[model samples]
Target: MDRYVSVKDIEQAALSLLPKGARDYYKSGATDEQTLAENKLAFQRLRIRPKCLVGVERCDLRTRALGSEVSMPVGISPTAMQRMAHPEGELANARAAQEAGTIFTLSTIATSSIEEVAKAAPTATKWFQLYIYNDREVTRNLVRRAEIAGFKAIALTVDTPLFGIRRADVRNKFTLPPHLRLANFDGHLSTKIQSTDGGSGLNKYVENLFDKSLTWDEVKWLKSITSLPIIAKGVLRGDDAVKAIEAGCSAILVSNHGARQLDGVPASIEALPEIVEAVKGYNVEVYLDGGVLTGTDVFKAIALGAKMVFVGRPALWGLTVGGQAGVKRMLDIFRTELEYTLQIAGTPTIADITRDMVRHESAYSKL
Candidate 1:
């Protein structure tokens, strides 16, 4: 922790420490990985136009997401099989988010059960990330369990009709270790992944178990089944965002499934502006989560109209490096950097960050 000064350092450390299979599974994106690289590159293309001598003194990073007050505008996004990164897994992530006064989302395919996370971090603001299963009962059961466990919302993933072609997983024959099971499911569904399956076992799992013919009706169905707010995750287009809202989604997560579901889609940041414009005048909140690595990235997304931004891999990197402590450190890093950004950028609070403060690098060329 003392030696690692940045998220990249932590990521490199985790990659060095993790086994080849788990390492590739966590790092690799879809075929060609064009969107994967673009998520970060897009952020770099945006420049912050800082204000000078605005009498900056204190900077506040507090904000609200999904009706809950958070310490900062950054939250944890769901990533599967976190136990591969650390022994404490989702439990550690929940605890870290709790301590940071932020939100933690548990993946549908998590290594820890919904009940386990609730009991472990009883006060954490938790959301359950869900996928509609081919068996409606399975999906229903997961939602019911999440609601019963005190999860605050349902982040319904709508992007992965089929898993993308991650070449790394295919070559590594990535499968969950024998010791860990998908804690939310029972029987074969819990431990379905096998190295003998030839290609990526997780890909095959989604192909066989997840619903492919889902429509906007499923969003209504999800709302019907639970009183929890439905956050439509993986929306990239304004039309889709509008459709999600019309179908009763309470929020839109502007994402391309972390560039894991498709090879050549817009980065979450790049897709954000259109969705924001489309959702204007709606009560629903919009969030982004594909590639957020630093404080400036968070500021840029907020300026572009994301109510909040989330990090998936950065949290994993923290968990891998030092479990709960590592995750907390990672969050602290973001919080501190964001505070500096707020003060230096002449915005003393989250609300002060506006679209005018961020400019595309191309904007300078015309001048």
Candidate 2:
């Protein structure tokens, strides 16, 4: 473990540490995993065309997102049941983000309570990830609670009205560990639907709570609940990007749910430039999160019009290995690799990164 090779190796190590069912649930992405493969392939398709001899020495990777400054243009994407990998769960993640001077997002389905995590990293940039439940009062209460706890933003996940076609989840009939609970819902969730077992127990909650009747007007409802800026997650189409912006979203995160919620959708990286173009002007910011595995991957996404990038599964992998320390180690590896990559590519600073560095196979970087 001391001599690190690649993020894939770290992932494989994490896989070895978990039970078969847990591994399947975390590692497999949607039906046939086509988009899962494409998320990584899209990055490969991007070729960096470097500019040389510019007297490059100092490299600046810091940037801003949602009016909050970031030490680097990256944040942790919301992932459920972090405790399944490590007992400390979201707290470890929050501390890691605090140490890195970036944002940490807590999933609606997270095992740790929002207040608990807020206490864990009191000064870090915190965002509460939301998935509207069938229960309106529940959603409103959670929003109010997040605001009361001083979370800076609210990110509504939109792409997964239905769970992805992941065969492994079905094969395993997964259930949340007995000690864990969806801490955000606490006493708010319906007990009648709590008896089911399959997918993440969180998914059963999803089936019960997700509003089938939710519409564009709902975004305004969320705004009225609390004054925190709303950042919509899961926009892959230009039309959807425009819709999110018009609905008064502060930022549009171009994600395919890390290619875990859909099998055929374009990679988030592939969809970024179009969304960035479609949502032009009007103070809208864009971010990307699917299939990013390295520091070079982060640099590439920013060059392709992503205001910031989110690292999803790799963060989980690092947590599985050594809690906060492993998370720190993994991010350090990516940062070092990216710094080396930027220097070698002759683009020393993040601003030096541009679309010319990437060559698209089609109009898209990778489908």
Most lDDT-accurate candidate: 1
Model 2 lDDT, full chain set: 0.82
Worst 10 residues of 1 by lDDT: 192-201
- Check candidate 1 and list the clashing pairs: none
Task: Kindly list the per-residue Cα lDDT of model 2 for residues 340-363, writing each as its tens digit.
Answer: 878877887788888787666564
lDDT (CA) for every model shown? 0.93, 0.82
TM value for model 1? 0.99
Error of 1 at 92 (Å): 0.6
Off by over 4 Å in 1: none
Residue 207 error, candidate 1, Å: 1.5
Off by over 4 Å in 2: 188-202, 361-367
Assess the local accuracy of residue 184 in candidate 2 as a C-alpha lDDT between 0 and 100. 79
Query: Which lDDT tens digits does candidate 1 get at residues 296-326?
Result: 9999999999999999999999999999999
